[model samples]
Target chain A: MLLIDDLHASIGDSEILHGVSLEVPDGEIHAVMGPNGSGKSTLAHVLAGRDPYEVTGGRVIYDGVDLLAMAPEERAAAGVFLAFQQPVEIPGVPTMYFLRTALNAQRRARGEEELGPVEFLALVDTKRRLVDMERALLDRAVNDGFSGGERKRNEILQMLILEPRLAVLDETDSGLDIDALRVVADGVTTLRGPDRSALLITHHQRLLEHLVPDRVHVLAGGRIVRSGGPDLAVELEAHGYATLDSPAVEPRTASAGTASIGTISTGTISTGTISTGTISTGTISTGTISTGTAR
Target chain B: MTAMTRPATARRPPSGTGVGMGVQVPERAREPEWLNAARRQAVAWVDANGFPSTKHEDWRYTKLDSVLALPLAASSGRGAEDGPGSVSSSDLPTPQLGVPRIVVVNGGMVPELSTLGTSLPGGVRVESMAGAVRRPEGRFQQLWTRRLGGYPHALRALNDAEALDAVVIDLPARTVVEDPIEVVFVSMPTGDARWSHPRLIVVAGARASATLVETYLSVAGAPSVTNALTQVELGTEAELVHYVLQGERTDSFHFSSLEGHLAEGSRLSSRLLATGGRIGRHEVDVVLAGEGSQVDLDGLFLTGAGQHHDNPVLVEHAAPGCTSRQLYKGVVTSDGHGVFNGHLVVRPGADGTDAVQVNKNLLLSERAEVDTRPRLEINADDVACSHGAAVGRLDPEALFYLRSRGVPEREARAVLVSGFAHEILERFGSGPIRRHAEELAAAAGLIVLDEDHCSSGAVTAGTVHPGRGGRAQ
Candidate 1:
């Protein structure tokens, strides 16, 4: 369902991914493994259509539409999801309120009937218990004051709720303990279906052992030098990046759309304080008390 | 004291004869020598300052033609000869628990309706301002005279000179009172112009605690003008929660000045609900005296149909480790106007101090208006402080959200506006006071929460579903 040709991208003036390409057929898992600066995160951010990252040269195709031709929110409504490497905090807005708003926003875009509070609350209740998150956490501001593991767990909960068709898991297992790792891995496993495809981006072979990938690609110097089965993760983890293809050899897709694109943007918020002011006065900063229009 | 020698800038006397008739500051006799001297000085200063007009910032959006045009003189009022009419507490509030309260009628203290608390904490002294002056209260002479007159308030200084009666309470160290102390002011007006000034000085010793409630009550058919000054003092670790409710007569004008000092680690929470009077002005000044002290200042005002209410408040944090918060809300309708000016000052060297001030207003009519400003002055770099003022319509989106949920339009508007004022109500800390304000707002015709005003399920998220806001939540 997802196809990426020789993609070359860059954030700003500098290029990150030279020419890297990959594809995930229906109902399959593809894992991208790389060293510290191999652009593992760059790929995920590029796919989600994060701005500031100039797609200097490349084309990305998902299903039959050009994935690059949509806004970030449009991509979201189109079923493209990217689990952040670091969840952000948004203060003031309650978790439940934000979730419902987002769900409705997507549903409206899709022209689907929105769910009522009763139905929405019921769905959230079932999902909360599935990830062992208490209802109190959902009721409080999103990700505010949450521990490292809790934020990761909350991300999984959102992933489950959004139910994207093409899910990109970026460093989802970084801060998890043994128990949390299994829970996260289990969430991913349960989400897999015949019509959905997922791309796992990771640095360690440890998480690979849990959510085993059907195909593995070794990334180095902004290029995917080699490809192998799940064993490739174990090999790269133990031996490192010495076997990267020579300079003469082309990395992958030569077209511009699917590359790392130099820079990246976008982050999540826990909650937001809407403290809005809608005074109908003419000027905001310098209006005289003459009219006292604020009243 | 006469109006001719008074400063040219002082407020012009109400045109012709004011609603107070023609009575001005009254000249008294047989009064103590010191009391008479202060009044002369006050009336002179007022003549100089003159009542401010729309041309001035503080009075912006507030009209003074009818107010300034009144023909007021130098005297408060001729006690017996000049009389607007007769009024009583019965004309104001419903009778209460025969808890005898000292009633001040037409600027005169009527001890006939007063009594000493049956069970008073030892060292707790409560009496009239005149009574204290008569007996000297044994307080150091320098402490009372020097500080009071050295920086006397223009109007207060004048009121002090001619004022007839007041309430004073002094609690000794470590004394904690179990019952509330109430002071009722009933204005009985006569003649053209009448002014009543009730001054209170409350001193709480170190570690002492007390709750003082001062209520302003005016009867029907009696139109008058009242100017009251109340002061509070706290010792180290002492606590005080003072509340004031203004329910004066319809034709009356009310002005009060509240000044309090909070000592080391001491705390104070002061709230006022001003829903009466054609024109009302309340000014509160709170000074944080010692380290680790905190103050909660809240005021809620509702005005309708030609009524004007103004609250000018200040909270000063002087020492390190002190905190203060202020929230003021107002709901205005008809051609009424509301003004809220809050000032928060954090002095230098006062580190670790946190201060926040906010003012919110809801205008129920296109003709009605509100002017809100939260001013913050911080000189210390190590502390945190902020102030914000917002005046807006009800949240259309939230309104829609509530409507789609089965709430009717009118009922939803009422509910939404009520929620807008909820924060201040919660801090009012008085159940009866809160309910009274809500009922007053509804009765003024700003909203109709009654069953007939709203249809069940009139509020829905989507079309045919609920509120007028676009799209569903």
Candidate 2:
């Protein structure tokens, strides 16, 4: 459902993401793993259309629309959600009020009727339980004085309410405790369906344990060096990114419109392996997807 | 404490000090001996020393050149052809239900329009300053004479010389006023330039507690000026909550001086919201006189094109173990100017005094300007005093956060701006007054409160006293 083709982007004088490409088909979750300063957060910001990150070259295509050409708010209306790594604190704005405004704005943009206070409150009550968010927190100012876990859970709650077609999680697991991580993972997994997809960005493989992804890609030196099954996450967790013998110069996919995406299955498949959720690297090499094989 | 100036003998007759100088006094006939003597001393002071210029230290940031140049005359208490009577009453806020309301048109209190005759709680007296002057004895006599002893302010002296009437509220010892006393001053400018002096005196006796609200509003019309004065005296253990809402027409001018005295163990909290007038200025001078007295002064000013607002606050800690805090915020846009001058004084023998002053401004346009000054004069040791000032535009990060959530840029800006001003607005005791203030903020574009969120239906307007019909235009 999403295609990022040779997305070269920069912030000021520094070029962060240099010619990176990735693709996630319909109804699948992908994990992007990278070490410190490998531009994981930068990639997420660029996808969300944040400013100060100039996309010098390449394009982002989501559901056949030019995603990079859209503003941040327009992208949100078009079913592209970016869960910020650090949610901002908006004082004097009630949390529930902001959430309802956002939901109504998206709905109005999509030519749907807006929900009233009663209906909106009922929806929040149901989704808030999914993340175990305190009811009192919803009455306070948005993210004001909220603990780290509460902010993360609030983000997950927003994701569940918005129910976007494509979700980009940017290091959402960084500051969460094990319990919060499991709650956030479950929230994201519940949003999974035949028409939904998510890109989980993190440095640790622990989050993958709860919500296993269909693909794992290791990002280094501003480029995705290797692509494999979920076993790669376990292998990398055992032996860090230093052990991966990635090629020094990898071929870049020129354009998302012309690039051949032959191996990507557009149809829904079984989740038999995700329930077991554990397969060794030795048993997954036959099904491993590599950047060298995309062309 | 600064010594009060002794009343000087009348050098010139009241007639010589009248008319062309922007001040007009009534006939001295039938006036009390002491009041006549006081008005004579005030008129002589105004004649001897004209209005102060910007060169004066206190008037440095505020220029009186424009006001001093206007061709001004005393307002005719009766409505004129082009006065407030010409405008519809729908623009004014409806008075809250069951509240004791005193309605002042122009400068004089219209007894027919006022609603506080014999309905006051026990030990409380709400009367006109004119009536109070007739029975000047005991506390009323003492407080009124003490005010006349100080004639250093030129404009205040002018007010004393010309103001014909005022609202006098007396809360006797141990009296607890259940409902706030609402004083609405409506200015109706005549065809020619006119000015009015509105005065208020509130005395909360020992252990007495009450809330007072003073709202200044005007109908849109020719140029006019309103010079107002309020005196508050809190006795031992007394508590008072005072609010001044100044919302005049933008082309009119307004100036108010609030002087308060807090006794031992007494507390005073005052909030001032200034959002209208061509040049709106309010000077607050509060003295924490008795031991253990406390005071809090909070203010918010919103200035748009062709408008200027100034707040000069002076807090004096006179006795030991007293506390004072001042927080003033300003939002200036396009051709607007704002000024905040907070002066704190810790006098001798006033040890253990705690004071804090903060002034913050948000300039929304390149042409907008604000000047903030915090001055501290400490003569006592072992006192805690601090002051700070900040000036900036809206937080761009907060703006982006709101916009990123799909809120339009205009609505997002409104949210952030409202948030900035909410710090002061929320302090306005909740209900109709606060809701009216929010509506004023929204009208001035400082905020955009959601219709349902504001609960404005509770404060349905149009119940205001319709403007009096005088000569047709």
Candidate 3:
């Protein structure tokens, strides 16, 4: 449902994402793992159409439509949702009021009839149980004085209410406790369907245990260096990203097969053997490419 | 005191016949000895101090040039065709919260037009000032003689000098009046320029409690000047809630002085709202005279294009254990200008005094302007006193958040502005008073939505109708 081709973006004088290419097909979940300053959050913001991040090159196609040409609200109306890393606290505006306005605005933009108060409240109540959000929180000013866990749950609640076609989760597990992570992961798992797509951006593989993805891509130096099955996450966890810096290792194509194993020298600058072999489970492709070190 | 003189540009009209001169006073022989002497003294004081110049500290931000240039005449007994004579109780701004109302047309109290019952509670007196002054031994005479000139103000002296009548409310000791006393002053100018000076005196005896709502409204596009003075005295342990609403014509001017004196353990809450007039000024001076007294002062002013409003409040903590609070908010749009000056003083002997003052303003347009000065003069060592003042526009992030949710930009701004004013309006302590304030604010194009609209499933936002002016409909 989403296709990003050589997307080059920058903020001010520094270019964050350079020639990054990836795709999340319909009905599949993809995870992007990168270290600090890997442009993980920057990619999410650019997708949500936030300002000041100039898209200098390439394009994004969502369901065959030009995604970069739409305004933020227009993107939201067109079923593009980005769960922010930190939800903004809007004082004097109640949460329920904001939700109803947003729901109606999106529905109106899509030529759908607006829901009445009773109908909107009924829908909200149904979604509130899915995310375990308190009714009192809905009555307060949007995220005003809310705890870290409550803000994440509120974001999930909004996602459930809007029921967008594509969802982008940026560091959704950054501040969650063990129980909150399970609940949030369950919320994302429940949103899985044949037509829905999701891109999970995180620095840790712990969240992957709760909500497993079909594809795991290691993003480093503003590019996706490797793509493999879910086992790639387990491998990255066992050995840290230091192994990915070996000169012998190269970029891998996702069709290379399931478990594209490589052997490397056990020294500071490891030299590993890259292989691209097709297995019955999946395909893995590896080739020699410039290994950009993580900053 | 030295004799005050006018500037070189000040024109001296015919001294014996003009409005501010000595001709407006009543015949000396027809009045009581004390009344005649008081009026003569006031008139002499006003002549000595022509009019307050901008150089005076109190009138620094407000200019009276346009107000002084108009030729002022006393209102005739016959009410103008478009005055209060044509207005029904249902047509009032806050008809939803009805109370026993007294109507004053031009400057004189109209008994036929008033809605006061034939009899009031025992030990409570509500009568016209003219009637009270005529009585041989009335309580109004005693209260007036003791309270009329308690303070020295040039415009207040002018009001007392040429005042024709007033509304005098007296509550005896230990009395608790249930309903609020509503006094509506309607100004309707004649063909030529005219001005009205309406005076009111309220005295709450020891342990007495009451609520007073004073409303000043003028007909559409009336060219008139309303110079009003109100003096309040609260005895030991008395409680009083005073609310004043000023809604006049955009082409007219309004000047009012509210002076309050609180005695031992007395509690006073004063609220003032100004939403009309080409230029309006409400000066309030409050003194906590006895130990353990408390006072609360709140005001809100909304000004649009070509309008100017000023509020200068002075609160004095004189006795130990006295407390005072002042919060004033203003929203200026277009070319409108607003001013707020709050001065709080804790005397040397008032060691246990507690005072807080805050003034916040929102400027909606590039041309809009606000001048806010919150001054604190703390002389007592054992006192807690703080003052704050802020002037800015709405938070850009908050605005963007609202707009991102599909609320139109104008409606979002209106919501923020309403919320800013709601902080002070909620302090009214009752739903009816707050609702009344919301109605008045809505009439001024401030976009106040009903509570049901928010709690219910309705997603409709409040709309702004600046063309409606101050009319209820």
Candidate 4:
């Protein structure tokens, strides 16, 4: 459903996502695993089209259309969701109001009728149980004074309400206790369906245990050095990436209009060197998608 | 404790001095010797010193050049020369101050408008400040000289130096005033550019509770000046809630200083709402004189259409464990200017004091103006004191969200302004008055209610319009 092709991006003076390439077909789960700072969060933000994360090179395509050209809210309306590692605290803005407004924004963008408050409330009540988030969170200001678990759960709640075509979860397990982790995993599992795709970004393979991925890509430096079945996660967690030799992943279907993604060497984690999220390795251009439902 | 333990100096008025030069009497009052004596002395001082000018720290922003341009009216006007009547009854204070209310028209009390039953607890004193000075056994004698200087205003000094008539409210220990005490001062424009100073004194004794609502209102659209001063003392364990609503005629001007003292364990909450007048300024000075006391100073102002409203609040923490919170908000439109200068000072050794001060303003027009300054001078450590201030226009995103939901352009703008001001108005404990203040706030455009958003006719639902740049005024 989403195609990222050799995308190169930067924040301020430092470059993070450098020429990264990836794609998730319809109804599939893609897990991008790398050590800390391997451009996981950056990729999610870049997909969500956050501003000032300047794209020095490459494009992002989603649902058979160019995604990088869209604004953040536009991308949001086009069914692209980014679950933040740390949700922002917007005090005084009630959660229900924010969620409803965001939902309507997306609906209105798609030329669909926006749901009334009554309809929205009913929908939220049913989904609240799926995420195990209390109904009280809906009445409060968004993310204000919420516990770490509550923030993560609230993100999932928004995701469930929006029901985007493509979902990018950025370190959803970072602050969660084991209980919260299970709850988040279950929420993701419930939302998994034929028309949706999820890209779960994580450092640990523990989340993979709950929501197993069809593809496990080890983003040791920046590029996906190794791509294999879910067994690669179990292997890395056991012996660490030290013994996991860097092998060339699948080659491109065809050379794109832009420069090919650069080769990357696996830097030892002990070096304490690279800031880790540099994206020159496997960044992909999103322009490959041609039209709606074209995937 | 000695009287000199604090900064209040006791001068005793040079005993025999008479009403000094340039000071004229407001009107004649049949008075007792001591009352006339204090008036003569005060008048004498004011006459010798005219009123404070731009050079005075407090009078700087105020342009009293009009006072200087006066064919000044007599200091006092009698029965036939009333100002409140000149002000159309429709414009006079509505929602009558429901108590044994006192109406001080101009600087002297009007008996026809004054209603007080002899229902009083024995030993309790409630009289006019001028009458208090005249009466040897009244409540004003003891508290007047003791607390007047605590709120220093040249006009107040002038009132004290020559205060022939003032309002004095005294609640005896353990006394409860079931009904609030209301004081309404309506400036009567009897002559061109006349200036009148009305002074008020309210003292709540130990365990006493009372609500005082002072409306510095007006009677005429003509240019007139009302300069006044109020001193309140809340004794040990006493509670006082004071609300001052100052809305003068567009052509008139107003200047007043309110100084309050809270004794040990006492609580006082005061709210100031400035809605009208060509130029209106209210300065509140609150000093927590003893431990375990709390004072709340709240204010809301709406300035637009060539109006200038200024509310400068000063809160002094003189003892430990004292709490004071201040929130002031306003909106300025069409050449209107709103100024809020809040100073919170924690003197050395005043520990564990929890004080919060915040000021937020919305500028509805490019020409609209706001000057917000919250100054904190904390000399004590281990204190939880915070202050913040901001001034800007309504949030466009919030506006868009509201409009997209079918709230029209006008109503949406009003909701945002009112919501911002609501944060401050919510502090007023009185619901009815708060509602009235909310309505009064509509005039300033500082806050607009939801009902205010709906335009006339086409009752059901309508498309929300978007307003940009300036007030689609």
Candidate 5:
């Protein structure tokens, strides 16, 4: 359903994503795990068509259409949704009003009949129960003065209403408590179907426990270094991302079983050094990843 | 009576022409001695000062060149060729709030057109200004003599001198009138260019509470001008809510001055909405005379195309422990000009005073202009005072958010502009008035959107006062 081929993007003078290649077939859930500054959020923003991120190279194909060529609203109409890391606060605009406008807009763009107020309200009531959103929150301004957990739940509510073909969750579990995480996870899990696919971007494997993924890819040095089953998330959580940086690492295919671990060379890589370190390593691996043969 | 064919140069009105041309005045010999003397003094004052020009600081942004050159005449009390006799109920600017309405046509009270239910509370007196002036006794005498003291502007003086008939509303001590008293000033200009000076005096005794709505509307298109003045006095612990709605013709001019004095523990809230006229200026002066008195002044002006609107508000915290707040917002589009000048003065020894003033404007077109000035003069050592003014376009982020949701660009811009004006409209305490304000704001938003999308239609074509004939100017 989604194909990202050697997508090289940058913001200003710094290139965040270099020759990153990944793909998620229909009816499957894929998780992209990386440490801080691993281009996890950058990849999500680029896919959502945020203007600040300049896509310098490569193309993204979704449902046999050029995704990069479409505007953000067009992408939304074409069934691509991005649950932002931090939902923007739009003052003076009621949540229900905003949601109704958005839902009708996307529907209209797709040549579908728009929903009337009564019908939209009924649909919103049904979806509100799925995420346990407070009834009062619907009347308040969109995400204005909302707590961290409410914003995430609101995002899920939108996802349920839009019912997009592909969903991208960026750090959805970062600021959530245990209860909120479970609620968000339940919302996402309910949307899983044969025709719908999701790309979950996170640093922790805890979210994976609730919404298990069919494929887990470790995005390091701006490239997918390894691909495996859900077990990769458990491995990364057990021994951090330090072990994934070893030389002569084998690229595990999506259907591969447990692979042998290489000998560890314990070298202290200080915190805050990953951003610059990953850029240098990414430059070296650009030649190979650009061929679209990394996955 | 000659029609104003084109913009006239700056010139003075005919000399010795009693302010407003003395069109509807009764015999001078029949007037009370004190009232006649007062009028003579006011006329003298106006003739001495003449009409204010751009050289004056208060009238700097609002030019009176074309307005002064019009053949200014006062309306005869009888219905003119172009008058409210032709104005239907649907032509009114705001929705009928079912209040006790007093309709004044051509500067005189229309008793047949007005409706004051028999259930009016005791100690409440609503009478014509001419009637009140004839009976020179107690409260009415005191209020008439103290007509907007201290601020001697030219137009106000003119209104005082030529005022043939005015509205006098007096509420005695502890009288609480549940129904609002609405004063509707309908200006209908005949072929000759005319001006009307309507005076309104409201006195709320100690612990008295009332709501007053003053609506200025022109039903005719003749080049007419309205220079209105309203004086309000709130006694100790008294509360009054005043609302002014101006919807004159685009070719005409409207100028209004409202002066309010609040006594100890008194509370006054005033709101002004200007959405009409080629040249509109509203000047509000509020004085917190006693300790613990409070004042709130909120205004919204929406101008488009060749329209120019100005609001100059001056609030004085004269006593200790007094508080005042002012918020004025404007939306100007397509060569429209808006001006907001707010002055907050905390008098000497008026310690413990708290004052805040904010002026924000939105320009929807490249040619739209706004001048916002907030002047804070604090003399007290122990006081909290702050003033801020901002003039800019709509928030691009807010616009993008709405557009990203698939709302058309024009619709998105309209929504954002409505939101900006809603902040001030919502401050109105009355439900019907607030709803009326919302309607005006929506109309203004549509006008802005239409201007943005199409260049052919003129902005002033969408008049707030619908179903009106005769094009002023």
Candidate 6:
């Protein structure tokens, strides 16, 4: 459902994603594992149409539409969702209010009737149980004073409510506990269908256990070095992205769209494989990327 | 005292008569002697200190050049339209709260327009100041006798001297008013700069509880100046919810002062929403006079294009175990100006005092400016006091978050702005008053709220649905 062709993005003068080539086909969940500063979150943000990152080259085609040409809201209306790694705390915007506005905006954009208060509330109540979100939290300002686990769950709740066609999870599993991870995984699984697609960006393979992906692509030096079945995650979990030195050597079987682009753009491929330990523990400064890093 | 001369740019008198020099004090044979003397003394004070210049410490950020240039010496009481005659009642911005309301036209209470009438509840007295002073043996004498913080402000003294009538709400001991009493001051100017000194005197007896709403509105873009003053006394253990909504014409000047005295264990919540007036200035001085008293002061000044609003609040902690919280927010756009000055004073021997003051402003444009000062004067050794002020544009991440959720940029900004004002609006307390304040915010273009949100008693997120801002193609 989503095709990214040699997407090169830069933050200011520093180019983070040199040539990211990946694809999440319809009805499949693809996990993107990378070391620190591999532009994993940069890909997610660029997909979501976040500002600050200049897409220097390449195009993103979602369901035959030019996704990069659309505004953030337009992308959302077109069924593209990005679950932020760190949800922004909006002090005054109520969580439920924002959700309903978003849901209605998307529905309206699709030429569907807007849901009234009663209908919206009913939908929210049904979705609330899916993520075990407290009703009190809905009344609060968006993500303000919410714990890390609750924020992750809140993101899942939004995902369930919006029910987008393509979902991009950017390091959502970083700060969540096991239970929250399970809930998030269940939410993603429930959203799985023939028409839906998801791209899970993570630094570890622990989340792969809950929501096993159809494909696992090791993203290193801002390029997908290897693509294999779900076993690729297990292999990386045992060894890590440090073992993957060569780039684009694996058979381009991730998707039909990626198979055409056999040779990924050759940029400065650093052999300095920043360990996942350094990626997860310390702050990784990737130019203006909203990954697992503090904004 | 030195006899100060009028400045080169003082206000021009309305006519060649001494009456228009200030608020014309009405003379009746049966009026109390003390009131007449107080009025005379106030007039003399104004004559000596004819409106402080910008050099004055208190008037530093506010310039009265435009206000002084107008012919505002004539009071609204005389030669004005009779009893809402000129302006139709439909033109008034009345909040449909379904409570007992008193309508004052140009500083004079019109009995025909007021709804209190004989339905006024027992143990409660809602009358004009003209009527209260004639009672001879009421609490109005004592409450009006005491000075407010011993600081005689220039505009306040002018209001005292020139004022003709006011709304006096007297709640007896232990009386709990179920509904709020709303006083709407409708200003319909007669083709000139008319000054209306509207006063409100509220005295809640011991253990009594009541809610009061004072609304100031102008009609037909009138050129007028509304000099308003409110004196409140909350008796021991009494509670009072005071809300002031100022939505005058952009060509009008609104100057309001509120003096609150809280007794032992009393609680006072003062919320002000200023959305109108070319230059709106409000001075709030609240004194925690007795032990265990608490006060919550919240204000939101939403201005746009050629408008300036200033709120200077002073909270005096005179007794021990008193708590005072001040939260003031402003939204300035398109060259609009907003100012907030919060002064907190903890008196000596007033230990165990907890005070917090926060002032936040949102400047939407580069020219939109806000001058905020949160000053703290701590005299007591053991007191928990903190003051902070922040002025910035809307959060970009928050805007992106909203937009990324399919909300358009304009609607997303409206949501964030509404949310920013929601903190202060929620402090208006639940029920119709809060709804009215929300409606006022929406009307001022400070926030965008839908119909469902307006009718809801408690403003919930469930009710907020932004307008369909150009459905994403």
Best by DockQ: 6
Give the number of the best model, judged by TM-score. 6
lDDT score, residue A81, model 4? 80
- Residue lDDT tens for model 3, B67-127: 7666645553333233554545444555634445777766667665566664456878777
User: TM-score, each model?
Assistant: 0.56, 0.86, 0.81, 0.66, 0.83, 0.87
lDDT for residue B467 in candidate 5, whole number 0-100: 15
Q: Is candidate 2 or candidate 3 better by lDDT?
A: 2
- lDDT score, residue B295, model 6? 97
Could you report the DockQ of all the candidates, in the order they appear? 0.03, 0.25, 0.17, 0.05, 0.17, 0.45
**Over 4 Å off, model 5:** A12-15, A218-226, A246-295, B1-30, B76-85, B147-149, B446-473
Q: Write the per-residue lDDT of candidate 6 for residues A37-155, one digit (tens) a residue.
A: 56788889999999988899988999999999999999999999999999999987778778888888888788988887888888999998999988888888889999999999999
lDDT of 1 by residue, A79-184 (tens): 7777777765543335665566556656766888877777888888888777889888876655779888888888778777778788888888887898778777
Q: What level of docking quality does candidate 4 show?
A: incorrect
The digit string of per-residue lDDT tens for model 1 on B41-93 reads 55554544445556655555556565444434221322222234444334434
Give model 2's docking category. acceptable
Ranking by lDDT: 6, 2, 5, 3, 4, 1
Per-model lDDT = 0.64, 0.77, 0.74, 0.68, 0.74, 0.78
CAPRI grade, predicted model 5: incorrect
Model 6: per-residue Cα lDDT over B399-452, one tens digit each: 899889998777787778888988888777777777778777877775543323
User: Counting only residues 3 or more apart in sequence or on different chains, how many pairs clash (N, Cα, C under 3 Å) in candidate 5?
Assistant: 3
Cα deviation of A182, candidate 6, in Å: 2.0
Question: Distance (Å) between predicted and true CA of B228, model 6?
Answer: 0.4
Tens-digit lDDT string for candidate 4 (A1-295)? 8887888877654455657787788888988987654567677777866654788887777888888887666777777787878776554446675576567666766888878767877898888887788887767666779999998998888888888878889899886888889987887888899998899999888898999998887775455677788998898899876565764332322233222222222222222222233323223233121111110
The model with the greater lDDT, 1 or 5, is 5
